[model samples]
Target: MPAPPPPSAAVPRRRWQSRLSPTLVRDRCYTRSFHSAGLRPAAVPLPDGAVVHLWLPPTAATGANPLHPVLLLHGFGATATWQWAPFLRPLLAAGLAPYVPDLIFFGASASPAADRSPAYQAACIAAAMTALPSAPQRYAVVGVSYGGFVAYHLAHAFPEAVERLVLIAAGVCLEEADLAAGLFAVEDIAEAASLLLPQRPEDLRRLVGLTFCRPPRFMPSCFIRDYIRVMCTENVKEKTELLYVLINGRKLSDLPKISQQTLIIWGEQDRVFPLELGLRLKRHLGDTSELIVVKDAGHAINREKPAELCRLIKNYIVDPSVKYRDDRKGSWKNAIKRFVGSSLRKVDSSRPLL
Candidate 1:
C-alpha cells in the first residue's frame, strides 16, 4: 500500500514473460530472409538531411545487373522488410535484383523536411537510387497499397528512370470525395489514420481484420502490444502527417497517368480500397495498363497471395508480352475456352483438328 513496492521490485512474472517479444523474433526472421536473399541493408543520406534505409543487392557496385534492377516499395503498417521479405528469394530466382526501401517516416527511414506529399516521397526515393554505387539507369518499380501512390508519383516525376510499373491494391485513382461518398468503411481521414497507426491492441486487431481476407486465427495480446509498441509508436506525429497529406484534398483530375507499361493487381475481396478503384485506375490509364484481380485475396495481397503476386511480377517485368487475362469473374482458362468455342461456330466444319 505504501508506494507500491518500488517500481523494479514489483514487476510481475507475466510482465517479464511479455518482454520476450514475438515482434522482435519475427523481425529477426525477416532480417535473415533478406540476408539469405543476398541483400544487405544500407542507409542513404539525402541532401535534405533525410536518411533512406534500404536492402540493397550484393552486386550493387561491381557486378550489378542493369537489366533487372527492381525497386520494391512497401505500404503502411510495417517496415519494407516485413512487407517484402517473402518476395526476395523468388525475385532473385528469376534473376531480378530487388532493392527494397523503407519510405520516409517508417522503419529506419526519416526525413526532416516539412513536405509530406507522395511526390516528395517519390523524389527522395529517386535521389536515393541515384546515389547508389553503379545505380541502374532504369528500373521497374513494384508498389503495394500506399506504396503504389508513391510509385505512381515516382513514375510521373522521373519517367526516364522508371521503366515499368506494378501497382498492387493501391487506390491511386481515389479522390477525397470518395471518402465522403463512403467508398471506405471509415467515415473520414481521422478514423482512417487511427485505424492505420494504431495505438492500442484492439485497434491493431481491427486493422488486421480489415487488411487480411483471412485474419490469423489467434494473435496473442502480448504480441499485439509488443508490435504496437515497437512498430507503431515511433515517429507518430510525422506518420500521421504523412497520412493526412496522402488523402486530404486529393483529386483524380490532378492525378497524372504514367507512360510506362503498367500492371495493376488488386484483391478481389479488397475492402480498404475497393476493386472499383482498381478498375477506375485501369480506365484512367487507358491501354497503357492491364488489371489483374487476384482471386480470394483482400487488401493484403502480398501476404495472402505471395506466390501468385511474384509470378505475375516476374512474368510482366521479365517479359511484358506474356499476357494474363483479367480473372475477375473466373479463371483466364475459362475465358479462353469461351472465346475458342464462340470462334468455332463461325469456322468451317471441314477444318482439321491440327
Candidate 2:
C-alpha cells in the first residue's frame, strides 16, 4: 500500500543542513578586496599539483550592485584570457564577479607532458576550485564549447562544491570522428597559445558573424581578428587527441546527485556540436534544468550574444523558481525525494528520452 506523502514532499532539500552554506562560511572567513584595486591576476593552487591561472575582477569597479561569484572556464586550446577579455565586461554589468581560469594544458597553467587524461583534468579543475578564496565556495560555473564538457564533468565529480552550472555550445556525448577533426580546425597551435601572437582582422569578423544573432559587421574583422592574432590557435593534433579521450571519458549517469541547477545555452546554427546535444543534455540533467537557444548564432554563444547571455544569467541568478531548490529540509521531505528517486530509478532508466 502507498503511504501519504508530506506536504513539502515536492520540495527537495538536504534533510539535515542549514541554509548557511559553505559559501557563507567562506565569505565570513576571507578578507575580500571588494574591487579595492583594479583586476588582479594570480596563479591559484589546486588540490592536485597543477596551478590554474585566475583573474579576480574588482568587485565594485563597474558601479553596479554586488554580483554572485562566477567561474568562467574557456574552450580547449585557449587561455583564460579568451573568456575574461570579451565577456568580463558583460558579466560585470550583470553584477557577477567573474573568476576566469586557464585550464592546465591551455593557458599559462603548467601542464606537464604526463598530465593527459580527462579524469585527471576534471579532478585538477575541482582541486583548483576548492583552493580559491571566495565568500561562498559554492559558485556558478560557466563553460563554453569544449569547456562545457569539462563543466558537466566537474559538477558531477564534485557535487557539493558547485552551486549552479551553465553550459554553452558543449560537445556531443558520442565519440564521432568528424567531431574530433573539427576541434583542430584552428589555423595554428603556437600562435593560438601565446597572447602576444597576432591574427587577421577579417577572420575575427567572419567568426563573429557566424557566432552572434545580430553581430556588428566589424566584430569579426576587428575585435575577434585582432584578438585571434594573439589568441586563436590551430591546435589540431593534441586537441583532437584530448577530445577522443574525453568523448570516451565518462557519462553523467549519477547526475541526479548533483543538487546544482544547470542552464544550457546553445546556438541554433552551431553546426559544430548542434542544438540536439544541448536539448538532450537538458533532459538527462533533470526537469529542473533549463535550455536557452540563441538564433542566428554559431558555436560561440557567449562571444556572439554577450549581452543576451548576460541577461539570461542575471535572470537565472534572480529567479529561484527555475532552479534546483529543495525548499523543505525535513526528514519527511528527504524520505520522499529519496523514495521517489529510488522507485523511478529502474522505470526511468528503461525509458529513453533520446
Candidate 3:
C-alpha cells in the first residue's frame, strides 16, 4: 500500500469550500424551480460561433398547445437563471411560456465575435428564435436593467416578431452624457463597470446596497466572496467591454422607439438607473407606453417585489386591452385604482356572457 500521499497543493481549501457553498445550494433551488415550471435547458447555436443558452418550454420544440411566448432577457450582474428564476413560475402560471436566455458571455452563453453592442445581442437572439423549431411567430419581450437595452434593440430590429414590450428598471432612455451630467452616483463608465461587475466583497456589498432598498442585514463576507467567485468572475474583460459599449457614446436622440405597446415598471427608490429614467422612457415612447412605479422598491424590483412585478406582467401580457393612466399625468395610486377598476369592469361585463 502506498502510504498517504501528500495532499495535492493545486486545489485551495477555498475551492473545496465553494463546492458546498450556500450560493450553490440556492442555485440548485433556482434550477429546481425552473424545471418544476416545465422549462428545459438548451443551447441555440448562432452562425457566428455564439451559443445562446436558453430555458424553453417543452412545447417550444413540438408546438403542441403552445402558450403565448415571452422572451426574458437578464441583467448584467448575474446570469439568466440567477436574475430571472423568480419570474419563471409566476409567468408560467399566467399562461405565458417563458423563453429565458443567457446573453452572450453570461452563464453558458458565449460568443467569440468581437461585437459587444446591444444590437449584436439582439441579432443573436433574433437569429436563435428564427432557428428554433416551431418558434412563436410573435412574442412579448420583458427586459430588466441591462436586459432592457437588448430587448429594446430586439423590438426595434424585429417589430414584426415582438408583439409587446415590458421594461423594468431599465434605463434605455439614458444618454451617454447622463453619467457626466450627474444622473448616476458613479463618476464615469469605469466606476459603473467596477460596481456592476464587482471583483471583491466590498464592491459587491456596495452594489447590493445601491440595488436593494433593504439589503440583507447580515451578508457574511465569505458568502459575498463566494458569490463573486461563482457569478461575477467568469467574463470580466468582455463584460467590462460591454459596459463601456453600453454607455460610452449613447444618446437619447439615437434611440428608436418601437411600435409595440410598452410597459415601464420602475422602483420609486431605485438608485441605480433612477426613476427619472423610467419616466424619460415613457415620454420617449409616448402614448404607446405606460409607466408604473412600485413604491419603496429599489433597482432589483423583480427580487424586491416579485409578486407585484408578476401581477403587472401577467395583466399586461394576457390582456391586450389592459391600459394604465396616460403618461401625461397621474399619481401611482391613481393609476393603480384606474387599472383595478377597469379590470373589475371588464370582469363584470364578461361574467354574464360567460
Candidate number with greatest TM-score: 3
> 1-354 in candidate 1: lDDT tens per residue?
556666676577546655587877788899999988888888999999999999888778455565688999999777889999988888888888888999999889999899999999999999999998878889999999889999999999999999999999889988888765656766578888888889998888877887778889899998888888878899988888888999888899989878999988888767778767777898899778877877788888888999889988988898867656444444423323433533221122121100
Global CA lDDT computed for model 1: 0.82
lDDT agreement with native, every candidate? 0.82, 0.56, 0.82
Which stretches of candidate 2 lie above 4 Å from their native place? 1-37, 46-48, 59-67, 133-135, 177-229, 232-240, 248-257, 322-354
Q: List the residue pairs that clash in candidate 1.
A: none
Task: Say which candidate scores most in lDDT.
Answer: 1
TM-score of decoy 3? 0.88
Per-prediction TM-score? 0.87, 0.62, 0.88
Which residue pairs clash in candidate 3? Answer: none
220-339 per-residue lDDT for model 3 (tens digits): 998898888778888899999998999888899999878999988888778888666776787789889888888878888889889888888888898888687334335444545544
Q: Worst lDDT window (10 residues) for model 2? A: 345-354
Q: TM-score order of candidates, best first?
A: 3, 1, 2
Scanning candidate 1 in windows of ten residues, the lowest lDDT window is: 345-354
